[model samples]
Target: MPFVQEALDGIEFARGDPNSTWGSVRAAMGHPEPFTLKYVAIGNEDCWKPHYRENYLKFYAAIRKAYPDIKMISNCDGSNAQLDHPADMYDFHIYQNANTVFSMANTFDRTSRVGPKAFVSEYAVTGDDAGRGSLLAALAEAAFLIGLEKNSDIVEMASYAPLFVNTNDRRWNPDAIVFDSSQAYGTPSYWMQHFFSDSNGATLLKSTLQANSSNSLEASAILFQNPMDKGNYMRIKVVNFGSSPVDLKIVIDGFDRKLLDSSGSKTVLSSTNVKDENSFANPEKVVAQVSPVKSLVEKTGTNMDLVLLPHSLTCFDVLMKSDITQITADDDSHVSSM
Candidate 1:
């Protein structure tokens, strides 16, 4: 009980007012403002242990009484079942092979929405398929992220695990970023994350796909404002996790086709082989390539056809008119391959 109390006390010092005891100590160290600490997990993946629930209750009660606004996270996974105890969010972790990771994109589709929101704190494509961050692993993870984006209402947060690995201590099988004493480079998984960078606060658009190879494809569309240029753009992200190429025809509706700028962009992350990986010697071997939409697609209006490469992740950004920032999408947009 004392240990738990002390931990909560530490949190109060970190985020509480400067007049508080712990806050006073922090202020005395030349930092007067409180830190932004809003969420705290009771423990890491300790839900199965016998004493986890008992100790969790103590910590939960103490923190709730002290800080009602702080979101408390439980170690238990509430995706498949409801948790017996109360929590603002529940932990969900997954580390599997490429196929399993990709197929698990719909893992939360049918989850009970009455329980606490899910926090996917740790997830990665591991084993032989993810040899030191291969492109195959990244493609599967991208598909999984697309699913999460589609289910954003039930999922509160999600993050990739093993973010950085030092070559000196090569313990983990695959990581997003690899570094050493001096040089550092991002793996395919790291590049994969850039496709979703504009997702925060973005409005998701209704999108559907009808194709023979739909099983090997995952996609989502969103409208977001670029913080730098203050430009409103619609991004359609797709992941093809198969060997054959796909000719996809995108038909966007609900907005003025004339409003879309012809100078859009298409970014793709792929290589000659699906299992290709990036290393210090060849960091750019599997990096994403950015090109003008006109260079890749014949047309840039509401209807366009794109040839998606195998085991690739593609993002198409269509710039909207400067005056328009918020607009609802119609239900007629569909993904089809001709």
Candidate 2:
């Protein structure tokens, strides 16, 4: 209660202060405008604190009265339990093994549809499976992201934690990007994020897989628009967690052979072993490799070969020449060429 105003002052900027204000702090330091302040989290991983709820409400009320437009995040998993105080969003963090995190891809599939949207701010496959940024951990995280993309209505925000780890420090290892005093390089987790980044603001398509294939294969399709040429594309991301390759055949309902171009790309993140990680000396050992895929489609929505490697995260970006006015699939629109 004693730290309410100060916390609000630091979070949303105190309303009645001139000498000690966020705007003035930015200007006095020689910035054109203040930093864009919209979201604020009460605390991180403070769900078990007895005074968390008490302190949270005090801060919430003060900030709400001053800045009614800002969204507040609560440090609790509303999916597992109910919240006493209201929040704009709820914080859900997970640090599990590769198999555990991969299976949690559908964690939000059955969550409550009402109340605040979720903010998966901290999540990663840690411990033995995530030893120094392994390919297995990246594939598991990619599967989880596909589930998030599918359930974007309930899950508003998501990100992997421990983005950087200095080799000398060596405390929070197996990060997305690793660095030392002089050199820095990305792990497989970093490359996996690049695939998901392209899907931002892109329209998620209505696509599904066979029931039997649900165990080891996680996939999602999106109508991604290229920002460069303003062209449309169909992106299919698949994560195969099994030990064997998946001879996958993509069937998009809607036959538009003329809509596709002669170009396509396949970005894969895999390694000889699922436990392979990148070290400072051998940084590129477990990174993703992008290679041009053969144009297997001729006209419209036809079956495309999306062979996924064993224990890999694969992204297939196919360029489309026209915008999709209708995404409905007719009898003739079935693309099963396998």
Candidate 3:
């Protein structure tokens, strides 16, 4: 396999085309065998060029004849397309503010039919450099991702684009993850990626949250069924963004358990000064801490007033006592602090 250019040159029909030659050379240097690439796009923003459509069709037809499994994707302006023209994927970009990002979760909620999956390949908080690449943006990104996770059955894949930019030599508006020479640091948006990636559970369980008000307190409960145990357990994630502490009284119904143990933990990402951020100089500026939560005695359920710091993420795991009969009620069951 020559590169993309050579592969295109090897095609007797595409010998004289420069763009075809480029694609051929791309394939050759990367792979020896006929590349099993599934998707290929023609032009990017330049799809509207005068010769681009014809060139795209030529490559598409050639690739289709050569490998039917490969799918051709083309960037086209406007909503309408030739019904007979073939395309396997459609790309859509979004760069709205926080309000719009919050509303987008329900944008396709009424979508009736499923066809080609949508790729939100590029998205970010636009406008206001003050909040553009700040930690608040990361919190918004996390909220947006919660929507994506809810709609993953429809969305095939999504990527945050304009991913990196040198602060001194920025060509675009702003990159989601940015760093300068000698130091690589993640923005608030970057933390959203880590939070989602690190906290993804084995399964997306059907759970619900009970909140007094959307602004003050919000809590989510996810039931994780243990493979070894016939009974299931619960993991509660509570976020208190308010200035005051919230007293969370949780009662889980429809489960039998002899041992019910619950521990609360808090991860504070806030600072005494609202504008503080973790940099290479002081890496541990914002971190999570494990504090002892008050236990409920003489009761079957758990109750505690969780002092969640303002603008913080807290995770709590509850393990049901497997063999309640083995221990005496007077016996002190050691609760592991998170």
Candidate 4:
């Protein structure tokens, strides 16, 4: 009974009728306790449907009374029904080209009101395998992710929709992550997710680049303090959109170079020629490779400069010095406690 109660505590169920006898069946299914469901979506992409408004209202009223605390989300676009019902979260879908994705980020940043935080539940570039699954798309996805991280406080939650695509039974053109039936492989966009999720840091530091051309690269540095330990580190993600390699002069105004001793740099290059992706046969064909640190120079009162490859993703980790005076002072304070 305790296990059943725990399972039902936060479970959201989908059904048409609230007074329907199915509630008992849900409880009977190894969970005799009623689940404290919070949000329930009426339907997916209901704006295009014919009977969406009527059916949605029916379900909305019934579910509202059945569980008054449950928050309802109507899956409708900007329409009369959405304005009328006014659910907790309004679902919206956006499928656009690479350029459009960039524009959307700027729009979100400027927009004053998009009541019910906009959830970019579905979005991706479209076209044949050449365009949809191209390196350009991957780069666009990375840029969009940067915008998302910058605006996480406003955006509630976002997911790359239609996650899987079977090359055999193809339905969608481009997906953030894709795979085939026989072999499951990730697209270049997939790498963007892995890189972002794995390397997201706690503090976002301001970064800018001085370049001669508009194609030159720039990025914001993210500082992450290890949650489990006191280990502190930094990730410098450089987005180079230039047609030619730009010589980058890196500088951390506040941090010291002793921190970068153990941390190494990794590059994810999606060169125009290297757009080939992984298949069942060739899994590691187009993955990111560790580029040797060409030249690293550290000095006082100067920026660190290095030549970055043209049109590439470069990440650098700068490890924090454990023996810094402040760190040592804190350690001394803890030692006194012992």
C-alpha lDDT of all candidate models, in order: 0.85, 0.78, 0.49, 0.55
Per-residue alpha-carbon lDDT of candidate 2 for residues 237-332, written as tens digits (9 for 90 to 100): 899998888777766654455667767888888999988877778888887789986665653245665567889888878877777545444432
* Candidate achieving higher lDDT, 2 or 3: 2
Instruction: Kindly provide the TM-score of model 2 when superposed on the true structure, using C-alpha atoms.
Output: 0.89
lDDT head-to-head 1 vs 2, winner: 1
Clashes of each: 0, 7, 15, 5
Highest lDDT scorer: 1
Candidate 1, residue 180: the lDDT equals 96
Provide the global lDDT of candidate 1 against the true structure.
0.85
Best by TM-score: 1
Candidate 1, position 96, lDDT: 97
| Colliding residue pairs in candidate 2 | 255-300, 255-301, 256-299, 256-300, 256-301, 257-299, 257-300
Better of 1 and 3 by lDDT: 1
Q: Please write out the lDDT profile of model 3 over residues 164-278, one tens digit for every residue.
A: 8786786765465557877766655555454344223322333344344455444444444445544444444554445555545544433333345543233444445323455
Q: What residue runs in model 4 are displaced by over 4 Å at the alpha carbon?
A: 1-39, 46-87, 113-115, 129-132, 176-182, 199-201, 214-218, 225-230, 249-262, 272-274, 291-306, 322-338
As for model 3, its CA RMSD to the true structure in angstroms is 9.5
RMSD, candidate 4, Å: 8.3
TM per model?
0.91, 0.89, 0.61, 0.69
Candidate 4 lowest-lDDT run of ten: 329-338
